[model samples]
Target: MSAALRPFDVAAIRAEFPILQQQLEGKPLVYLDNAATTQKPMAVIQAITDYYSQCNANVHRGAHQLADEATRRFELSRDKVASFIQAYDRCEVIWTSGTTEAINIVANGIAQRLKPGDEVLVTEMEHHANLVTWQQACLRSGASLKIVPIHDNGALDTEAFAALLSANTRLVALPHVSNALGTVNPIQDLTRLAKAHGALVLIDGAQGIAHGGVNVREIGCDFYAFSGHKVFGPTGVGVLWGKAEVLQDWPVWQTGGEMIAQVTYHSATWGELPNRLEAGTPNIAGVIGLAAAIDWLTQFDVSAIQAHERALLAYATTLATDFEGIQLVGTAADKIGVFSFVLQGSHPADVGFLLDKQGIAIRTGSHCAQPLMQRLGLPGTARASFSVYNTLEEVDALFRALKKTQRMLA
Candidate 1:
């Protein structure tokens, strides 16, 4: 937490998002599906509107005044993103559609370098975005895929991870925080262990960045990926931060006008660090809006927000435990604001449907983690994910809704 930051005020924060004030089914909306995407604050929304209304132009290609202003704001957003994650060089941050595309960019680049018998390591708890990309990469290159196991408590098995690394391990990809279970992985330790074996590390930070500070240098991972929508920014924008030297040598997977330096009818040379990987026009307004979101977040102490969320999770957990037949999933000692659980003799989708009648929104189904669900021996769990703007009253409302749902089902 910064000393200069103002103390967090939940009420004030809630007021900044107009969408939260809406009514659903004649009841106030209680949005708990934050893991899927966070609602944008007015600052972020206005940033997008202002971009199109005031300075609508393509970046880095036109010589007009609007183009110049648009380009300046777009690149400034890049600088803000670089600073947000504490990257060593601003040029190391490459824009992508989201975490999914960012992971694919690295996976594809690494696939070109992979040889037969080289191993790509992942974990049993990874989101499909992190897991499937490496799986496909391994298939393309004839390299084997290795998985580190997780304990019954939803925590990564450190002993198992240590044993998996070896001379043939070329890369180790894992999530900083599990989206389904909310387990905060020991990324620093994992990165050190993998690096000791000369394996490149990529940290999927989609859930981690939303919780609090993330310093890539301290973690010492080769690459970090996250999405803007998960971090109070606009959708269709994301960032991939890599070591400058590592990205410099990475093969370009996308090619078009912006990525090229010199081109003829025969062949072409690629551009520098960031642009080489980012081909064609990007989501210009979304990038600007993401910078606004970052700027808005800087006003409050992130530590305060994290503490509030921890309290909410604890409160919600206690309430759920008292409810008959409500079984909590992911009991890791360290977790974030996610609460995943199952109701005995009830389907997760049915529970979600009942909650929706009370104007409560949550996520159900596999959560893009079917393998994780299979590992836990369940179909899926209804997930209620919290954010900075949520309140304790809302937490209580969730349980009340659950009680009503339980009686109706009975």
Candidate 2:
């Protein structure tokens, strides 16, 4: 935690988000759908509004005063993003639509280099964004895709993961945290092992970015990708952070204006590291709002926020354990934010529907992880993910609603 910040206050934090004050079906809102997307705070909303009201001009191409201001803010936000993840160089932080597009950018380059007998390693807990991207990359390149097994407790099998890294492995893609199960992987050690084998590692950071401090240098991964909407920012914006050396020569994901340096009727040349990958007019307001979101989030102490989240998860776990007919899924010791479970003799969708009637917002079904659901031998689970703004009272409300849901289903 930063020395300047005081004790964590859930009430003070909750007041910053206007959306949380509303009601559904005459019940106060208890939002637990954070794994899907987070609600924006007033700081982020004001930043977007200020951008459109003051400087509504294209970046880097306009010569007018509004253009200059717009370009300055746009580039400054890029610097803010570079600092947020502790990235070594600003050029390595390429803007993308979200984690999905970021992963595809890397996959596009790797697929061109892969050949038969090469392997790409991934885990059984991947969101479809990371899993299907590599799957298709391997299919297109004739490389074998190897799946690392997870234990019944939802933790990654470290022994199997190390064994799978062989001379044939060219890339290792894994999620920093499992979106479906809320299982946090040991990414630092995993990245070290992958580096030892000379294979590139990409961490899908959609779930991990909002939980705690993430230092790219300390993790030693070549690439990390995350979405802004998952961290109190605007939608349609994300960041893909890569090693400067690795990204300098990465094949461009798209080709258009802003990405080109020189062009002829027959051929053209690409721009530098960041712009080379980011083609056309970018998501201007989204990027500015994302930068504001991170700035607001960092004012609080990271350790304090993490401790509060851990407490929420611990209390929720205790309540779930004693609740009859409720079976908790993803009981990994290291997880913090998500609580996924199923009701005995009831479908997950039915549980979610009943909970919604009480103004408890949660996610149901595969969570973009059908393979993980199949691995656990279930249809799907109802997931309730916590954020820093959520209160202990909200967690209790979720359980109370679940009790009501159970009785109604019976």
- Backbone collision count in every prediction? 0, 0
lDDT of 2 by residue, 176-247 (tens): 999999999999999999999999999999999998699999999999999999999999999999999999
Off by over 4 Å in 2: 1-3
| C-alpha-based local distance difference test score of model 1 | 0.93
Please report, as a residue range, the 10-residue window in candidate 2 with the lowest summed lDDT: 1-10
- lDDT per residue, candidate 1, 1-410, as tens digits? 56779779988899999999999989989999999999999999999999999999999998899999999999999999999889999999999999999999999899999999899999999899999999999999999999899999899999999999999999999999998999999999999999999999999999998987899999999999999999999999999999999998799979897998999999999999889999999999989999999998878777787899999999999897678899999989999979999988889999999999999999998899989999999999999999999999999999999999888888
Q: What TM-score against the true fold does each predicted structure earn? A: 0.99, 0.99
The true-versus-predicted C-alpha distance at residue 381 of model 2, in Å, is: 0.2
What overall lDDT goes with each candidate model? 0.93, 0.94
Cα deviation at 163, candidate 2, in Å, is 0.4
Assess candidate 2 and give its lDDT: 0.94
